[model samples]
Target: MKKISIIILLFSCFVYGQNKQLLYNFTDIPQSLLSNPGAEVNYKWHVGIPLLSHIHANAGASGTSVYDLFADNGIDFNEKLRRVVYSMNKNDFFTVNQQLEIFSGGFAIGPSYEKNKYLSFGLYQEMDLHLYFPKDYAVLAYEGNRDNIGRVFDLSDLNAKGELISVLHVGLTTKLNKKWTYGFRGKIYSSLLNFKSTNNKGSFVTQEGTNNFYYHTFDLDLAFQTSGFASLVDLENEGQNDWNGKAIKELRKRVLFGGNLGLGLDVGFTYHPKEQWTVTGSIQDLGFIHHTKDVETYTLKGEYTFEGVNPLFPNNGSGQTADEYWQEIEDTFDDLFELDTITKNYTSWRSPKLNGSVSYKYGKKVLKECNCTAEDGDYLNEVGLQIYAIGRPRRPQTAVTAFYYRRLFSFLSGKVTYTADTFSKTNIGLGISSHIGNVNFYIMADNLLEYQNLAKANYASVQLGFNYIFPATKK
Candidate 1:
């Protein structure tokens, strides 16, 4: 159990905001297409530089931080653990997400005279995880019910979901007159692995009994389902041996549409209410996958009452062997409470995300003075507010951010943002994009204030990428 907790903590460190609000409208980089297909593109063509194209990792925890557990201040480790567990609520959760662009490129497909139509395509891999705090179960397992005799442990506290998938997508963006631009993307998802164990019900209670000093009752209905994982574990020697590299090889082969497949769609639109004001919205990953291969499920459902086991001596036998007595007790316990493991196919859905923003440019006249075309509404300075939401098992999580963008020079631009979300309210982020003769470089980070004392931070994220772009010919 301690090992499991450590693993969870380590994973949580890799988690927060998938929104990337600061980079949303930054049209200098081609990777912004993934977030909003309708985002304006000023370049004629762009290509991501191999593996260094786009790499993003974000993680967040709502309840505690690494400093809460590992900070050495002469306090007992067990006492610290107890304090951390008790301080957390049942709804607290840890989330982690990562995305890497394997290969990507885009180009204008229409005639040279007509620059309104463009096509973009890419293949990327992503992993997402969400684990809720199991407060009742943790207390019951860690401290036991001996201290609190009447406390009841609720099974609903166990809720978690995780998935790893690769996405191949193609998108088309076109201008629909002078005020509106729309885009659509079609995605093919190849699921590498998945796990889900929500929707549980029941409880465990210990109280005074009529005949025995204490009585225990357990009514549990639980099911844990997983796919593409069991076959990777070698149980020949009771799971003591490592996998023989066959599963990883198979997974690698399936990265290109060979695994469990699914379809998704992204739709977005940009509306220009006025010359200086614009509104943009997008919805992504509206799809599901059917897991039909290498699936495993475990279920436990029963109601049992224990009033202390009573030993019986048989008259026919001179003396009951220790193994026989223990075997009899185990068999009786199995009869009272049963657990079943089965293999069956299942279906899972991708978490749908929504993003919307409104921005107003203020220094457009300055661009004209600097000999900038400003045809695509590129402004020298702008401020905007962005809202983001994603659907989860329990509820939808939401975040909001206010950002300021500045085009410092012809080749350099930057953005600053302040965000409020489930993790923290004082999240300040910065993003910078630079073009050195058509070679584009961009990087962004969140929670800048916590970098000095990272252990006290509940959330942190950074994204960096490089791309090669060809400028549009001067008219």
Candidate 2:
């Protein structure tokens, strides 16, 4: 049942135009939502796996992994498709790149130092892996199921096991930095994404349907984030002397590089004059990632017919004999296979991000003296009201907007809350931390709100972790 469910899910994504629609609204929304407008955040990191879901339709349901694959592949195909002035340019259509498969994972440890009046730093290490599947095999899997009539047919066998690629992030912390602190990370990311797929011309007769689905070997991708831009800028400029008072056009083109480059940065800071509140912000994921692959295309055709008597496979029952059923199906479809267009384009791309947080802290602890002394018993309780913007610059006519708040009960416990686009999406979080003989234990529950989005079936998270703070000492 689970397998069937998953398969159904995959099919729905393929046929339902499952694509991540870009968010283009700015209004009262949650801080979390605003922080990463079009980009997916690592918020689900603590949940064990990356959150591939979308927050678009109240349900937050994201397109399947194949949707992502196809979109990216489509981007490549579209580019190549644009250059072909002739539809019969099969040479431009069929091209293949070598398949490369790579995988790796590891761990690390270290300490870092931050030089800021209110910042401290610590060091750490991590491990990660990268994977790539060649286009030939990928397209072959896509066209593996074909019917008669030269319609290369079946859609069910295109499923490919997604590589379990992982990456470790370990680095310095800008703790104590009252404002403006910086940190660095050393990341090692590697993987094998090599794949091959092929489709042979063939015709099949069946009771499934009349129009045969043709299979084509070609590269498909949604975007060139890592490839397009690189190819564009790498061009070298060369020009010949002008003739007849006309300037010569400069000849230039991008050079393809073998290895990919990864970039990252982490900077955060805070300001708190009084003992109660502070303002903080930072930027993350400021870099680019690359993926390479070989592509292939194929052609196919199939036919489907309907007959009355057969009850085993109902839907307009196919005839008793498989051949008879196929014969009837052939009546619906004629020639299924024919020469078509095949094309490939090369390009690269990139994505950038920014985020910030702020809040007003008010409470007894904040309003009282430094600490409870012999003269002063206890202080008043404290509460915090926070609001911040992330993602693109805040606009008035946007669809979604957000801000987050946290009411702190001293330093041991507190509540985290957020509101997005008014009552559209709201989240409440609670956390507590206590020290048992110098050992500190903490737990937090996020997304307390009941949100209905296309991207999410049901989204909630609970995390348990501990951090130890060494006591300040005198030398």
Candidate 3:
């Protein structure tokens, strides 16, 4: 039943990792500044379309797809379930990441405007959930220990994390000389809720004993921490009449300055070492969050050995009764886990991200001379190799992408990317940015090959946004 439950979870829920191959260096959209603070901007002033500026979400399972289970075949459903379980390993994981831009705008500033200097600001809300497959736990729960005596099941397999937070940020960008341009962004993070249980250590082992068919031993050192959740639960307890209004009020407070807050920084730059070649690099989320309010940490540490347990009642009924026997079993579990809860403050680091790319451009697309604007990237074609990495709880996730860019018209441009990562090497993505007068709109998506049958795709993601821009005017 546990295995079935896991399969169901895989079928209904999943998340795409935070690798936006199509949008990473697509600088036409102002959102590119979020990824690379130093990204070049041609607009003198810009404003996002309120909450519609950017909306992004990606969903899929890493190890299996829904079609794998529901496909009509001659095989029995139980057999299909068994195959799915056996195919997964501890390395398989599920994750969900989403973001919404609330309000954003930027404009040219001061005397630096003549030198291409600009200031930008924005606020956004984000959510992330990551969980790894508990392979050993599933096996032990489904098959029991009698079949695999002496095999140790690792407790470390139970690793997962979830968080919901909002960020308000401001950045400064400027072009220095002809070869280098750089920028930095300062962010304030307001955490609404967070939960993580990772870095576990322990083992569960079963072996033959003198008194029974098998003996079991549990050694555990595990912790689970959370914030902003206790207050929500207390609010729900108030009753259904005012729960909606109160919850909304509470969420608004948390998303703003009322919740646990932290600070972070992002820095990046572009370098033109040659006329035709370019290099760029950036680092994001270099910060940590201190969970001091509405915080709770649960820990389980201790060791226990169990020889066996018998539930058979004596014929005379003179020994232990049913209630006492069950109570004894419950006491045994409590002793082994030694569960304890404490309201303690803790600090958690953000999953810092790294991005770097080398690109070459050619094929000039001559444009009509303009009085106010200098030509930037006159070339119509570009090719590049980009590397990406993001820190995770257990290890750093990485990916490599090869991309090509083309300018189809004065107002239309497109990019195509081929990426190789932990999910799959055949991942292909496309992004298009269009300029109709002063409105800038762009959309990007990954896993294009699976569009025909999205249900069978292991990874998929898309991002779209609209913004208004005022063209630069030379002073």
Candidate 4:
């Protein structure tokens, strides 16, 4: 559940990251990415069930800023194993951060309910488990006093099991007026995010290896919004819950408060000279939020220096035994260099975007166009073409502009009937939508690239949803 929730969150971010292609194409529909469920409205509710599968890999490099630190201080020196010792003296030792490339894949599938142009509500159960992860390492080696040509090691080769997490979400939205809308939602999540390495002691021998431990944690969420969608603040995982089942010598308890808030404005106007052509534009996700907070924890690594020993072994000559030497070494090391607990905290600030679109429709696909011959229902079909542009803040060169065309087939199934939009890039998708007697159903798929490309984080995704539209029939 937690895994699926995470995937949904990632998908939302990737799609609506900054009003690019999928959800918010600056099409006049107010969209919310933080909550899985949407709000209610007057138009047909767009219910979506989306399933996403992909593999994400780190493609950057680990630099030298960290290597220089390990060399300057023998404290974190990689004595025998060519790896630096961490957690020995937390506050003093330099912290190293690096990037890597690895094969990691997972999938998420669930139902989503949403009402378009009126109000929207949503709920979904999802899970995206990771079968593999990148191999990262921090090496510390010194040669001939000055010229230290460190040897690169692949730490990812160590054996580790896959992890599965899950999440559930529910949301609601309502329109206060023509220009103002409001929404709220709550989420519950749990992560079985635990794993162990295959090397056993060989991997756990040093700080670099010992750092491969896993833990399970759960989080919470609280959010609300007002029309015009000026800004929103999300509060998540404020603290840990009570756990009395585990039998540990020491059960320490800690509390934390964290999440992100956005502050911005969305202003757009549609221009339709012939009523058949509509153009819209808006700047989206213009503000930044902290995705994660810096964390500080203990990462200890060190060795024992023997003292009392036999004559052949040296230290205490033939008079002392191994126990005496071991005890002496332990006492000396403990007194000379004490252990330190580290606490780290950092924040991730994402980029914003600017988007716009021009769409042209050939017919009226509304309630007035009941051209269906069926005596029981109304169906409207129309053809549409749209040219859209999307740009990111940091990397403008990667900006993408696409042209889309959608063909509405029929509404005989009790709702809107439309096929997925096909872009000029030759990417094809399917769309199934319907709204009958206040019940709405919608499904849309994007990208649809090959399965192998999906793992590369370079493919398309599919979304299907169902929503019940309850208009304020009475006062």
Q: Which has the better TM-score: candidate 2, or candidate 3?
A: 3
lDDT of 1 by residue, 1-475 (tens): 8898787657545555466776787778888788888886767889999888999987568878777876788999778778888999988888878899999999887766878877899999998888888889888888898986888889989998888899999999887767888899999998888888887888899999888888888888888888878766632433322344566676777688877888999988888899888899988899887887778887878777777644346554547655676677677678645667789888888888898999998875345476865665556898999999988888888889999999888889999999998888998999999999999999999889887877778888889999999967755
- Which of candidates 2 and 4 reaches a greater TM-score? 2
Question: In what order do the candidates fall by lDDT, top score first?
Answer: 3, 1, 4, 2
The lDDT of each candidate is 0.82, 0.29, 0.83, 0.29
Task: Give the root-mean-square deviation of each candidate in angstroms.
Answer: 3.7, 19.1, 4.0, 16.9
Q: TM-scores, in order shown?
A: 0.90, 0.39, 0.90, 0.37
Please write out the lDDT profile of model 2 over residues 67-120, one tens digit for every residue. 232344446743432232122211111111111112211111224232222122
lDDT for position 408 in model 4 = 44
lDDT winner, 1 or 2: 1
Q: What count of clashes does model 4 give? A: 52
Off by over 4 Å in 1: 235-244, 310-329, 335-339, 365-377, 473-475
Off by over 4 Å in 3: 1-12, 72-74, 236-245, 309-330, 366-377, 473-475
Pick by lDDT: 3 or 4, better one: 3
Largest lDDT belongs to which candidate? 3
